[model samples]
Target: MKALLVIASLVASIMMTYAASPSLEKLQEGEKIKVRYTSQGCFHSSNYLMDFSPNKVSIYEFLDKKNKNPTKIGELTLSDGDTAGLDKLFAFYGNGKEKIGCTTVDNISITVIDKDGNTKATYHYNDGSGQAHRLEGVITLGEIVHRLRP
Candidate 1:
Protein backbone atom coordinates (compact mmCIF):
# COMPACT_ATOMS: atom_id res chain seq x y z
CA MET A 1 0.00 0.00 0.00
CA LYS A 2 2.86 2.36 0.77
CA ALA A 3 4.40 1.74 -2.65
CA LEU A 4 1.11 2.49 -4.37
CA LEU A 5 0.72 5.71 -2.39
CA VAL A 6 4.24 6.80 -3.36
CA ILE A 7 3.58 6.14 -7.05
CA ALA A 8 0.36 8.16 -6.90
CA SER A 9 2.14 11.09 -5.31
CA LEU A 10 4.81 11.03 -7.98
CA VAL A 11 2.21 11.01 -10.72
CA ALA A 12 0.35 13.92 -9.16
CA SER A 13 3.52 15.96 -8.97
CA ILE A 14 4.29 15.38 -12.62
CA MET A 15 0.79 16.35 -13.65
CA MET A 16 0.94 19.60 -11.70
CA THR A 17 4.19 20.56 -13.35
CA TYR A 18 2.77 19.96 -16.79
CA ALA A 19 -0.39 21.92 -16.09
CA ALA A 20 1.38 25.00 -14.82
CA SER A 21 1.82 27.74 -17.41
CA PRO A 22 4.67 30.22 -17.45
CA SER A 23 4.28 32.99 -14.89
CA LEU A 24 3.86 36.47 -16.40
CA GLU A 25 4.15 39.89 -14.84
CA LYS A 26 1.44 42.55 -15.17
CA LEU A 27 2.32 45.21 -17.71
CA GLN A 28 1.51 48.84 -16.98
CA GLU A 29 0.78 50.98 -20.06
CA GLY A 30 3.33 51.58 -22.82
CA GLU A 31 6.75 49.96 -23.23
CA LYS A 32 9.12 48.35 -25.70
CA ILE A 33 9.38 44.69 -24.91
CA LYS A 34 10.88 41.35 -25.81
CA VAL A 35 10.12 37.68 -25.06
CA ARG A 36 12.21 34.54 -25.37
CA TYR A 37 11.26 30.92 -25.61
CA THR A 38 13.47 28.29 -24.00
CA SER A 39 11.81 24.94 -24.03
CA GLN A 40 12.65 21.57 -25.50
CA GLY A 41 15.59 22.13 -27.87
CA CYS A 42 14.35 25.26 -29.67
CA PHE A 43 15.05 28.93 -28.89
CA HIS A 44 13.62 32.16 -30.36
CA SER A 45 12.96 35.84 -29.55
CA SER A 46 10.55 38.61 -30.57
CA ASN A 47 10.20 42.38 -30.04
CA TYR A 48 7.24 44.74 -30.26
CA LEU A 49 5.36 47.74 -28.89
CA MET A 50 2.27 47.56 -26.71
CA ASP A 51 -0.71 49.82 -26.04
CA PHE A 52 -3.93 49.35 -24.12
CA SER A 53 -7.17 51.29 -23.86
CA PRO A 54 -10.04 50.72 -21.48
CA ASN A 55 -11.35 47.76 -23.49
CA LYS A 56 -8.90 46.95 -26.25
CA VAL A 57 -5.31 45.71 -26.60
CA SER A 58 -3.06 46.71 -29.47
CA ILE A 59 0.37 45.33 -30.42
CA TYR A 60 2.54 46.88 -33.09
CA GLU A 61 5.75 45.71 -34.69
CA PHE A 62 7.80 48.19 -36.66
CA LEU A 63 9.08 46.39 -39.71
CA ASP A 64 10.45 49.51 -41.40
CA LYS A 65 8.36 52.43 -40.06
CA LYS A 66 6.34 52.42 -43.25
CA ASN A 67 3.55 50.16 -42.04
CA LYS A 68 2.54 48.53 -38.77
CA ASN A 69 2.87 44.77 -38.61
CA PRO A 70 -0.01 43.33 -36.63
CA THR A 71 -0.29 39.66 -35.88
CA LYS A 72 -0.24 37.37 -32.88
CA ILE A 73 2.32 34.58 -32.56
CA GLY A 74 1.54 31.43 -30.61
CA GLU A 75 -0.25 32.08 -27.34
CA LEU A 76 0.71 35.72 -26.97
CA THR A 77 -2.79 37.05 -27.41
CA LEU A 78 -5.09 37.68 -24.46
CA SER A 79 -8.07 36.67 -26.60
CA ASP A 80 -6.73 33.23 -27.35
CA GLY A 81 -7.77 31.54 -24.15
CA ASP A 82 -4.56 32.58 -22.45
CA THR A 83 -5.62 33.02 -18.83
CA ALA A 84 -2.09 34.34 -18.29
CA GLY A 85 -3.30 37.78 -19.58
CA LEU A 86 -0.66 38.52 -22.22
CA ASP A 87 -1.57 41.68 -24.14
CA LYS A 88 1.08 42.04 -26.83
CA LEU A 89 2.69 39.97 -29.54
CA PHE A 90 6.22 40.10 -30.91
CA ALA A 91 8.30 38.31 -33.52
CA PHE A 92 11.93 37.45 -34.03
CA TYR A 93 13.44 40.33 -35.97
CA GLY A 94 17.02 39.65 -36.99
CA ASN A 95 19.54 42.26 -35.98
CA GLY A 96 20.78 42.21 -39.56
CA LYS A 97 23.76 40.06 -38.62
CA GLU A 98 25.09 36.58 -39.21
CA LYS A 99 26.32 34.19 -36.56
CA ILE A 100 28.57 31.18 -37.10
CA GLY A 101 27.86 31.40 -40.83
CA CYS A 102 24.14 31.00 -40.07
CA THR A 103 21.48 33.66 -40.19
CA THR A 104 19.77 34.37 -36.89
CA VAL A 105 17.22 36.80 -35.50
CA ASP A 106 16.42 38.07 -32.01
CA ASN A 107 12.68 37.51 -32.28
CA ILE A 108 10.23 34.64 -32.82
CA SER A 109 6.53 33.82 -33.05
CA ILE A 110 4.88 30.93 -31.26
CA THR A 111 1.96 29.66 -33.31
CA VAL A 112 -0.18 26.66 -32.62
CA ILE A 113 -2.37 25.03 -35.26
CA ASP A 114 -4.84 22.26 -35.13
CA LYS A 115 -4.59 19.13 -37.23
CA ASP A 116 -7.13 20.64 -39.60
CA GLY A 117 -5.24 23.93 -40.03
CA ASN A 118 -7.30 25.87 -37.54
CA THR A 119 -5.45 28.60 -35.68
CA LYS A 120 -4.62 28.05 -32.06
CA ALA A 121 -2.29 29.89 -29.68
CA THR A 122 0.02 32.66 -30.97
CA TYR A 123 2.87 33.78 -28.68
CA HIS A 124 5.31 36.65 -29.11
CA TYR A 125 9.09 36.43 -29.10
CA ASN A 126 11.43 38.51 -26.97
CA ASP A 127 15.03 37.36 -26.87
CA GLY A 128 16.81 34.07 -26.56
CA SER A 129 20.51 33.91 -25.60
CA GLY A 130 20.73 31.28 -28.29
CA GLN A 131 23.54 28.78 -27.77
CA ALA A 132 25.48 31.27 -25.65
CA HIS A 133 23.07 33.62 -23.81
CA ARG A 134 20.33 32.91 -21.34
CA LEU A 135 17.47 35.33 -20.68
CA GLU A 136 16.18 35.69 -17.12
CA GLY A 137 13.06 37.83 -16.78
CA VAL A 138 9.45 38.28 -17.77
CA ILE A 139 8.38 41.20 -19.97
CA THR A 140 4.91 42.69 -20.23
CA LEU A 141 3.38 44.62 -23.12
CA GLY A 142 1.94 47.37 -20.95
CA GLU A 143 5.39 48.02 -19.53
CA ILE A 144 6.96 48.45 -22.95
CA VAL A 145 4.23 50.68 -24.27
CA HIS A 146 4.36 52.86 -21.20
CA ARG A 147 8.03 53.54 -21.84
CA LEU A 148 7.52 54.59 -25.46
CA ARG A 149 4.65 56.96 -24.99
CA PRO A 150 5.32 60.70 -25.08
Candidate 2:
Protein backbone atom coordinates (compact mmCIF):
# COMPACT_ATOMS: atom_id res chain seq x y z
CA MET A 1 0.00 0.00 0.00
CA LYS A 2 2.84 2.38 0.78
CA ALA A 3 4.44 1.74 -2.56
CA LEU A 4 1.19 2.36 -4.39
CA LEU A 5 0.68 5.59 -2.46
CA VAL A 6 4.13 6.82 -3.41
CA ILE A 7 3.49 6.09 -7.05
CA ALA A 8 0.21 7.96 -6.98
CA SER A 9 1.87 10.97 -5.40
CA LEU A 10 4.50 11.02 -8.09
CA VAL A 11 1.90 10.82 -10.81
CA ALA A 12 -0.07 13.62 -9.30
CA SER A 13 3.04 15.80 -9.09
CA ILE A 14 3.84 15.13 -12.70
CA MET A 15 0.33 15.97 -13.74
CA MET A 16 0.46 19.26 -11.90
CA THR A 17 3.66 20.23 -13.61
CA TYR A 18 2.38 19.25 -17.02
CA ALA A 19 -0.74 21.29 -16.48
CA ALA A 20 1.20 24.52 -16.14
CA SER A 21 1.27 26.88 -19.12
CA PRO A 22 4.52 27.25 -21.04
CA SER A 23 5.14 30.72 -19.66
CA LEU A 24 4.57 29.52 -16.14
CA GLU A 25 6.92 26.64 -16.71
CA LYS A 26 9.63 29.07 -17.71
CA LEU A 27 8.97 31.10 -14.58
CA GLN A 28 9.43 28.00 -12.46
CA GLU A 29 12.70 27.22 -14.16
CA GLY A 30 14.47 30.13 -12.44
CA GLU A 31 13.68 32.93 -14.86
CA LYS A 32 14.34 36.16 -13.04
CA ILE A 33 12.03 39.14 -13.77
CA LYS A 34 12.40 42.69 -12.62
CA VAL A 35 9.99 45.65 -12.70
CA ARG A 36 10.80 49.21 -11.81
CA TYR A 37 8.63 52.32 -11.58
CA THR A 38 9.70 55.87 -11.02
CA SER A 39 7.65 58.95 -10.34
CA GLN A 40 9.39 61.68 -12.27
CA GLY A 41 7.74 64.42 -10.30
CA CYS A 42 9.02 63.01 -7.03
CA PHE A 43 12.12 61.24 -5.85
CA HIS A 44 10.16 58.14 -4.85
CA SER A 45 10.66 55.07 -6.99
CA SER A 46 9.91 51.37 -6.67
CA ASN A 47 11.89 48.44 -7.97
CA TYR A 48 11.26 44.72 -7.69
CA LEU A 49 13.05 41.54 -8.60
CA MET A 50 11.13 38.26 -8.86
CA ASP A 51 12.60 34.80 -9.02
CA PHE A 52 10.18 31.88 -9.07
CA SER A 53 12.56 29.38 -7.65
CA PRO A 54 12.45 27.94 -4.12
CA ASN A 55 10.88 30.46 -1.75
CA LYS A 56 11.54 33.18 -4.32
CA VAL A 57 8.44 35.37 -4.54
CA SER A 58 8.09 38.14 -2.00
CA ILE A 59 9.95 40.46 -4.41
CA TYR A 60 13.24 42.08 -3.54
CA GLU A 61 12.79 45.83 -3.78
CA PHE A 62 14.63 49.11 -3.60
CA LEU A 63 12.52 52.19 -2.84
CA ASP A 64 15.20 54.59 -1.78
CA LYS A 65 16.38 57.67 -3.62
CA LYS A 66 19.72 58.41 -2.03
CA ASN A 67 20.82 54.86 -1.24
CA LYS A 68 20.83 53.48 -4.82
CA ASN A 69 20.66 50.02 -3.33
CA PRO A 70 18.01 47.39 -3.08
CA THR A 71 17.10 45.94 0.29
CA LYS A 72 15.24 42.72 0.83
CA ILE A 73 11.74 43.70 1.80
CA GLY A 74 9.25 40.90 1.21
CA GLU A 75 9.78 37.23 1.89
CA LEU A 76 6.73 35.89 0.08
CA THR A 77 6.95 32.67 -1.84
CA LEU A 78 5.54 32.49 -5.37
CA SER A 79 3.00 29.72 -5.50
CA ASP A 80 2.01 28.09 -8.77
CA GLY A 81 -1.35 29.81 -8.58
CA ASP A 82 0.30 33.19 -8.13
CA THR A 83 2.47 32.63 -11.13
CA ALA A 84 -0.59 31.74 -13.16
CA GLY A 85 -2.28 34.88 -12.00
CA LEU A 86 0.72 36.92 -13.07
CA ASP A 87 0.54 35.22 -16.42
CA LYS A 88 -2.98 36.49 -16.79
CA LEU A 89 -1.97 39.99 -15.83
CA PHE A 90 0.73 40.26 -18.48
CA ALA A 91 -0.55 38.00 -21.20
CA PHE A 92 -2.58 40.80 -22.68
CA TYR A 93 0.60 42.55 -23.65
CA GLY A 94 1.97 39.61 -25.61
CA ASN A 95 -0.68 39.57 -28.29
CA GLY A 96 1.83 40.36 -31.08
CA LYS A 97 0.84 44.00 -31.07
CA GLU A 98 3.21 46.30 -29.26
CA LYS A 99 1.02 47.84 -26.61
CA ILE A 100 3.39 50.76 -26.24
CA GLY A 101 3.06 51.88 -29.86
CA CYS A 102 4.54 55.34 -29.08
CA THR A 103 3.17 55.58 -25.61
CA THR A 104 5.25 56.34 -22.56
CA VAL A 105 5.18 56.67 -18.77
CA ASP A 106 6.95 58.62 -16.08
CA ASN A 107 9.63 55.98 -16.13
CA ILE A 108 9.21 52.22 -16.16
CA SER A 109 11.39 49.25 -16.98
CA ILE A 110 10.67 45.55 -17.04
CA THR A 111 13.18 42.83 -17.70
CA VAL A 112 13.11 39.06 -17.92
CA ILE A 113 16.20 36.93 -17.71
CA ASP A 114 16.58 33.23 -18.36
CA LYS A 115 17.73 30.73 -15.75
CA ASP A 116 21.31 31.22 -16.85
CA GLY A 117 21.04 35.01 -16.38
CA ASN A 118 20.61 35.80 -20.06
CA THR A 119 18.15 38.45 -21.11
CA LYS A 120 14.93 37.05 -22.49
CA ALA A 121 12.89 40.21 -22.94
CA THR A 122 12.83 43.82 -21.88
CA TYR A 123 10.43 46.79 -22.03
CA HIS A 124 11.18 50.33 -21.05
CA TYR A 125 8.88 53.36 -20.93
CA ASN A 126 9.32 57.00 -20.20
CA ASP A 127 7.49 60.36 -20.26
CA GLY A 128 3.98 59.28 -21.23
CA SER A 129 0.91 57.53 -19.84
CA GLY A 130 -0.01 54.79 -22.27
CA GLN A 131 0.80 51.76 -20.19
CA ALA A 132 -1.02 53.00 -17.13
CA HIS A 133 -3.02 49.84 -16.86
CA ARG A 134 0.04 47.63 -16.97
CA LEU A 135 1.95 49.87 -14.63
CA GLU A 136 -0.94 49.92 -12.19
CA GLY A 137 -1.26 46.19 -12.45
CA VAL A 138 2.42 45.85 -11.64
CA ILE A 139 1.95 47.99 -8.56
CA THR A 140 -0.93 45.83 -7.51
CA LEU A 141 1.16 42.78 -8.20
CA GLY A 142 3.85 44.13 -5.93
CA GLU A 143 1.31 44.48 -3.15
CA ILE A 144 0.14 40.92 -3.68
CA VAL A 145 3.72 39.73 -3.80
CA HIS A 146 4.43 41.47 -0.54
CA ARG A 147 1.48 39.81 1.13
CA LEU A 148 2.92 36.34 0.61
CA ARG A 149 6.22 37.38 2.12
CA PRO A 150 7.45 35.70 5.23
Candidate 3:
Protein backbone atom coordinates (compact mmCIF):
# COMPACT_ATOMS: atom_id res chain seq x y z
CA MET A 1 0.00 0.00 0.00
CA LYS A 2 2.84 2.46 0.82
CA ALA A 3 4.66 1.76 -2.43
CA LEU A 4 1.49 2.28 -4.43
CA LEU A 5 0.85 5.59 -2.72
CA VAL A 6 4.33 6.87 -3.48
CA ILE A 7 4.02 5.84 -7.10
CA ALA A 8 0.71 7.60 -7.42
CA SER A 9 2.07 10.80 -5.93
CA LEU A 10 5.04 10.76 -8.25
CA VAL A 11 2.80 10.21 -11.24
CA ALA A 12 0.57 13.07 -10.25
CA SER A 13 3.55 15.40 -9.92
CA ILE A 14 4.81 14.44 -13.36
CA MET A 15 1.42 15.02 -14.91
CA MET A 16 1.14 18.44 -13.35
CA THR A 17 4.52 19.47 -14.68
CA TYR A 18 3.60 18.36 -18.18
CA ALA A 19 0.25 20.10 -18.15
CA ALA A 20 1.65 23.40 -16.93
CA SER A 21 2.64 26.10 -19.41
CA PRO A 22 6.29 26.97 -19.65
CA SER A 23 7.56 29.49 -17.13
CA LEU A 24 10.75 31.52 -17.30
CA GLU A 25 12.71 28.65 -15.79
CA LYS A 26 11.65 26.19 -18.47
CA LEU A 27 13.08 28.39 -21.25
CA GLN A 28 16.10 26.68 -22.79
CA GLU A 29 19.04 27.68 -24.87
CA GLY A 30 18.70 27.50 -28.69
CA GLU A 31 14.95 27.33 -28.31
CA LYS A 32 13.29 29.56 -30.88
CA ILE A 33 10.84 32.15 -29.58
CA LYS A 34 8.69 35.01 -30.89
CA VAL A 35 9.32 38.29 -29.06
CA ARG A 36 7.89 41.83 -29.49
CA TYR A 37 9.28 45.11 -28.28
CA THR A 38 8.58 48.85 -28.43
CA SER A 39 11.15 51.55 -28.93
CA GLN A 40 11.62 54.73 -31.00
CA GLY A 41 10.02 53.07 -34.03
CA CYS A 42 9.37 49.44 -33.09
CA PHE A 43 12.08 46.90 -33.91
CA HIS A 44 11.58 43.17 -34.62
CA SER A 45 14.07 40.42 -35.24
CA SER A 46 13.51 36.75 -35.98
CA ASN A 47 17.14 36.02 -35.38
CA TYR A 48 17.09 37.94 -32.13
CA LEU A 49 18.81 36.02 -29.37
CA MET A 50 22.06 34.18 -29.62
CA ASP A 51 21.61 33.63 -25.88
CA PHE A 52 18.81 34.21 -23.38
CA SER A 53 17.87 33.96 -19.73
CA PRO A 54 14.88 34.84 -17.59
CA ASN A 55 16.57 38.09 -16.70
CA LYS A 56 18.19 39.17 -19.97
CA VAL A 57 18.49 38.34 -23.68
CA SER A 58 21.18 39.47 -26.06
CA ILE A 59 19.94 41.13 -29.26
CA TYR A 60 21.47 40.86 -32.71
CA GLU A 61 20.86 42.67 -35.96
CA PHE A 62 20.29 40.94 -39.24
CA LEU A 63 23.48 40.50 -41.20
CA ASP A 64 23.96 40.53 -44.93
CA LYS A 65 25.11 37.28 -46.42
CA LYS A 66 28.56 38.68 -47.13
CA ASN A 67 28.95 40.30 -43.73
CA LYS A 68 30.91 38.10 -41.37
CA ASN A 69 30.25 38.36 -37.62
CA PRO A 70 26.84 39.94 -37.39
CA THR A 71 26.74 42.95 -35.11
CA LYS A 72 25.64 42.57 -31.48
CA ILE A 73 23.18 45.40 -31.17
CA GLY A 74 21.78 45.50 -27.62
CA GLU A 75 20.25 43.51 -24.81
CA LEU A 76 16.71 43.16 -23.46
CA THR A 77 15.90 42.42 -19.86
CA LEU A 78 12.69 41.17 -18.32
CA SER A 79 13.36 43.46 -15.41
CA ASP A 80 14.19 46.44 -17.60
CA GLY A 81 12.36 49.43 -16.19
CA ASP A 82 10.46 49.80 -19.44
CA THR A 83 9.21 46.23 -19.68
CA ALA A 84 5.77 45.54 -18.28
CA GLY A 85 4.77 41.95 -18.98
CA LEU A 86 5.50 38.77 -20.91
CA ASP A 87 3.02 39.71 -23.62
CA LYS A 88 5.66 41.96 -25.15
CA LEU A 89 8.18 39.33 -26.31
CA PHE A 90 7.94 37.51 -29.67
CA ALA A 91 10.24 35.77 -32.20
CA PHE A 92 9.79 33.92 -35.52
CA TYR A 93 11.74 32.79 -38.61
CA GLY A 94 10.74 31.69 -42.11
CA ASN A 95 12.19 31.18 -45.60
CA GLY A 96 10.50 30.98 -48.97
CA LYS A 97 11.02 31.54 -52.68
CA GLU A 98 9.47 34.32 -54.69
CA LYS A 99 8.14 34.06 -58.24
CA ILE A 100 9.78 37.35 -59.25
CA GLY A 101 13.00 37.71 -61.22
CA CYS A 102 15.14 37.39 -58.11
CA THR A 103 14.94 36.17 -54.53
CA THR A 104 13.26 38.20 -51.82
CA VAL A 105 14.69 38.20 -48.31
CA ASP A 106 13.41 40.02 -45.25
CA ASN A 107 15.02 40.06 -41.83
CA ILE A 108 13.03 42.15 -39.31
CA SER A 109 13.23 43.44 -35.72
CA ILE A 110 10.23 44.73 -33.72
CA THR A 111 9.96 46.90 -30.64
CA VAL A 112 7.21 48.85 -28.90
CA ILE A 113 7.26 52.01 -26.84
CA ASP A 114 5.03 53.47 -24.15
CA LYS A 115 3.98 57.10 -23.99
CA ASP A 116 7.02 57.79 -21.84
CA GLY A 117 9.46 56.50 -24.45
CA ASN A 118 10.42 53.23 -22.80
CA THR A 119 10.93 49.82 -24.40
CA LYS A 120 8.29 47.14 -23.88
CA ALA A 121 9.79 44.17 -25.64
CA THR A 122 11.85 43.20 -28.73
CA TYR A 123 10.88 40.77 -31.50
CA HIS A 124 12.75 39.29 -34.46
CA TYR A 125 11.55 37.86 -37.77
CA ASN A 126 13.80 36.61 -40.54
CA ASP A 127 11.85 36.10 -43.74
CA GLY A 128 14.27 34.98 -46.41
CA SER A 129 13.31 34.30 -49.99
CA GLY A 130 14.84 33.56 -53.36
CA GLN A 131 13.35 36.74 -54.82
CA ALA A 132 14.94 40.17 -54.89
CA HIS A 133 12.24 42.05 -53.03
CA ARG A 134 11.88 42.12 -49.24
CA LEU A 135 8.79 42.68 -47.13
CA GLU A 136 9.19 43.68 -43.49
CA GLY A 137 7.63 45.67 -40.68
CA VAL A 138 7.96 46.53 -36.98
CA ILE A 139 4.75 45.67 -35.16
CA THR A 140 3.39 45.64 -31.63
CA LEU A 141 3.47 42.60 -29.38
CA GLY A 142 -0.29 42.48 -29.40
CA GLU A 143 -0.36 42.27 -33.19
CA ILE A 144 2.08 39.38 -33.49
CA VAL A 145 0.55 37.46 -30.59
CA HIS A 146 -2.86 37.75 -32.19
CA ARG A 147 -1.57 36.67 -35.58
CA LEU A 148 0.36 33.74 -34.15
CA ARG A 149 -2.22 32.44 -31.69
CA PRO A 150 -4.55 29.72 -32.88
Ranking according to TM-score, highest score first: 2, 3, 1
- Against the reference, the lDDT scores of all candidates come to 0.37, 0.53, 0.38
Q: What is the lDDT of residue 109 in candidate 3?
A: 50
Where model 2 places Cα greater than 4 Å from the true spot, the runs are 1-22, 37-47, 93-108, 125-139, 145-150
Residue-level lDDT tens digits of model 2 in 94-118: 3334443432234545677777888
Flag regions of model 3 displaced more than 4 Å: 25-45, 61-71, 80-84, 87-150
Best by lDDT: 2
The TM-score leader among the candidates is 2
Deviation in angstroms for 125 in model 1?
11
Root-mean-square deviation (CA) per prediction: 15.2, 11.9, 13.5
Q: Could you tell me the lDDT of residue 147 within candidate 1?
A: 39
Task: Supply every candidate's count of residue pairs whose N, Cα or C atoms clash at under 3 angstroms.
Answer: 29, 7, 36
Tell me the lDDT of model 3 at 7: 100
Model 1, span 1-150: residue lDDT tens: 999999999999887644432222333233222332322223523345433322234555454534356444222234332213342122112232233422343444444334455533444443333322221232334333443442
Compose the digit string of candidate 3's lDDT tens values, residues 88-127.
2221222222232323334445443333555534434543
- What would the C-alpha RMSD of candidate 1 be, to one decimal place? 15.2
Task: Give lDDT for model 2.
Answer: 0.53
